[model samples]
Target chain A: MSGAAAFWRKYGVLFKSDWAIMMAYRSETLIWMVGAFVQPLVSLAVWVSLSGEGSIAGYTASDYVLYFTAVLVVDRLTRAWDVYELDRDIREGTFSAKLLRPFHPIHWSINGNIVYKTFFAMLMIPSWLLLAMFFPAMRIPVDMGTIGLVILAIALSSAIRFVIGYQFGLLAFWSNRATAMYALYEGIHMFLSGRIAPLSMFPDWVADAARVLPFYFTVAFPVDLLTGRLADEPETVWIGFAGQAGWLLLLALSLRFIWRNGLKRYGAAGG
Target chain B: MIHVEGLTKIYRVHVRQPGFVASLRSLFHREYREVAAVDGINFDIPEGQIVGFLGPNGAGKTTTMKLLTGLLHPTSGRIEVGGFVPFRQQNAFKKRVSLVMGQKSQLIWDIPASETFLIHKEIYEIPAASFKERIDYFTEMLDLSLIIDKPVRQLSLGERMKCELVAALLHRPDIVFLDEPTIGLDVNMQEALRRFIQSYNRDYKATILLTSHYMADVSALCERVLVINDGKLIYDGAISKLIDRFSPMKRITLVLGAKIDTSVVEAAVRNGGGRVVAYDYPQLEVEGPREEVTGLSAKLLTELPVIDLTIEDPSLESVIGLAYSEGAAGESRR
Candidate 1:
């Protein structure tokens, strides 16, 4: 078979397998999805109370609701749990099974990301529309062209986050603290990725710092795009896409480097 | 089908002492050491041959297997399995080789074992017709018809192992590396898996390299054995030759109808260049060279009323025990 044909065949089967696994854990999946809402809602509640009848950093109470809602959706859609899975698999030695396969291990994780993201989108998008019918704050008034760019940004954001998480997990070859280390990274990401609040709500220095790092591009850029905050700023929109693309390329390269060197250090531990 | 020369894998490991003080000390000044997991080893395996790898824990059998299957990269050495460098781990190379570690599972948890089989079929690019035919044959041979749809997490260890074998062999790989395949299985299950592996080898002519803690597995499935210890290959030959080299003595058992003087039996055994290992009334057990077993039996038959006489070679377990000792000895000398 041609290379692309072979890859498509394998990815299709892997995707089907991952979807079945997700279905088997549908209840837990729902619980996780619901659980992820807590942080964003809490941030929204805080921002709304602080705004009351006024506005803070140009974000009124209704704007806070929409912004956090966008955060919730964008965060869930782009989130990657590969660090946890890869860390456990590598530490427990089940990773050797993945390494021995003809298919790359990263594709399995990527397939899983695709499966879970599609599953979440299927549930989230219609719910957002349904909620928007009664609550004006849940509505997005962007054009279809802007919606296309939002999607491109979300996918690029997801790819960047997935590669970063995967590389963190591959650190298991060198240390047993891979999960803990990724947790630290995730904690920083929680604040700087703008999941807790809009980048504008933070101080100028903090917002600039988030932009300087890869943090803002992963979550805030898509969140901003989805909430229509970038509707009037086409140049900023393109810059966000460019940032996401640049980081995605860099992280993907880092993944190849880490994988090539890591296997040399792999003990294949207990397996 | 497989070749190796100076194949070595060295691991850099953290060294720590046991204590809160040591723990605190290690935080700032950590120590590291190098361990040669698979030190300079050499061997060749022909296709269609089932070879057993005998080694104690930390003996590097699994490391060597991992190197051959491309799951690991050797620190230094040359290895070619089926004409491809295993460490390169090319797609074509991976498709022709399979490694099954008893302690590690590749099956997707929370899903049926058959799901993994389908994924394996695609990853290996097996034709649809052959895929169905292979699964049907394997499931029937393994008696997995009833539980194939059950979640792998819910399956018993033996049942999971049976399904794992099906997943590993679905591609009909040219080389199969089995690391302790029957580690946690019941006697009957182990026997069943051994039979399945033997049949698979016979049908596909796949080169099988297997390691097991159970000597029964080796004795039943492998005619040739490689004994390794401390990361070095100490002995490589037929299992029978190994037994002959390490344990030249054969065990002889005699049951006499009448009680005889213990001194007489002891002296007769000694004169026959053998030692009486045990003596209890009408039953006496002695171990001697293969040549003297018959002569010793003759003297016993004529000197006393012999009711039974049997001669048997030493068990493979004992032979391996001796082999490991020599290997450890060789390590110390180096």
Candidate 2:
């Protein structure tokens, strides 16, 4: 088989298997999905209550809802949990089984990310559409060309996050602090990636830091695109995509380096 | 085929000493020592052979298996499996080998064993007919037809092990490394697995390297064995030769027709170049060199009031124990 054809064949089976497992714990999955809404909804509510009839940073109460709504969908679609999964697998020695397979182990993590995101997307989009029917704030203006760009940005953002998370997971070969370290990074990312608040609401210095670093591109840029906030600024949209692309490339190379070196240090620690 | 030359794996491990003070000190500064898990071991296995890797726990049986399977990079020395350096882990090399560790499971716990089989099929790129053929063959051979669809978490230990074997062998790998494959199994299950392994080896001509604490597993399936202890190969050859090299005695048990003096029996056994294993009013047991069993037994029967007598070869456990003790002795000497 050709390379792409072989990849699809393997990915298809992996996706199918992961889908079954996801379905098996669907109640727990639904709970996690519902629980995720609390943060974005809470932030939206706080901002709305504070705005009242005014804006904190040239914004209205409804705009806060729209921004948080966009944040919800984009974060869900682009989020990855590979860091936790990889940490546990490596720490517990299940990773050795994965490494022994004829396929590269990274493909398994990729397939898992695809499966979960696909699951989240299937649920979140319809819910978003339903919410839009009732709440004008949730509605996004239909624009085919701009929607396509948002998708491309979200896909790139997901790739960046996945690579970063996986590299953090690879640190388990040396120390048990991999997950804790990633958690620290994630705490920073929560603020800078615009999950907790839009970058525009932050102070100028923090806003610039979020933009210049990889954090803004991971979630906030995709949210901005989805909310049509960047449609007028074509140059900024391109820069956002460029930021995502550059970070993804660098992180992927680093992941390759980490994976190669990590295998040498793999103790295969358990029976 | 597998080739290992002076293959050594040294692990630098944190010395986690006992007590709160040690733990506190370790937080700031930890001591470490490099221990050779596989100390310059050398061996070669031909294709289509079943070879037993014998060793006590922490003696490097599992470490060598991991090194051969490319799960760990050896600290030093060389290893080649199927004309490829195992640590390089080429896809072609991985495709040709399978490892089954009794303590670690590869099957997904939440899903049916059949699901894992399907996943393995795709990863291995096995053709449909070949995949189906092997699955059916392994299922029938392992008696997994009924349990294959059950979630692995729901299966008994033996059933799960059978499913694990099926998951590992569905691709028909040319080299199989089995580490304690029959561990935690009942006698009947162990027998079944041993038979399945023997049949698999015979039919596919796959090179098998296996380790088990059960001596029967070695004696029944493996014609040759490599005895390793203290990270070194002390004996490598046929099982019988291992017995002769280490345990040179044949156990002889004799029933006494009446009570006998303990000193007299001890002297007689000593005279035959044997040690009195146990002595009671009604029975006498001793072990001596195999060649002396006949002469010694005859003399016992003629001199004492012997009711009945029987002789048996030393158990493989005793032979392997001696091999390990000798290795420890050599380690201490060095």
Per-residue lDDT of candidate 1, residues B1-334 (tens digit): 9988899889888898999999999999999999998889888898899999987787889889988988788989999999999878798998899999898888877899999998988888898999999989998999999889999999999999999999999998979999999998999999999999999999999999999988689989999888887798877878776776678889988888988888888888888788999999778899998767788778767776889988877665567678776653454222
Q: For model 2, how does the per-residue alpha-carbon lDDT over B1-334 read when each residue is reduced to its tens digit?
A: 8999999999998999999999999999989998999999888999999999886678888999999999999999999998889889899998899999999999999999999999998888888999989888887788888998988999999999999898888888889999999999999999999999999999999999999988789989999888888798877788766767677789989999888789988887887778898997787888889878888888777777889899977665566677776663454221
Candidate 2 lDDT by residue in tens digits, A201-226: 88999999899899999999988888
Candidate 1 chain A lDDT trough over 10 residues, lowest sum? A262-271
lDDT of 1 by residue, A30-104 (tens): 999999999999999999999999999888999998999899999999999999889888887788888898888
Sequence-dependent TM-score of model 1: 0.89
Global CA lDDT computed for model 2? 0.89
Score residue A25 of candidate 1 by CA lDDT: 87
User: How well docked is model 2, in DockQ terms?
Assistant: 0.68
Instruction: Give the CA lDDT, 0 to 100, for residue B314 in model 1.
Output: 67
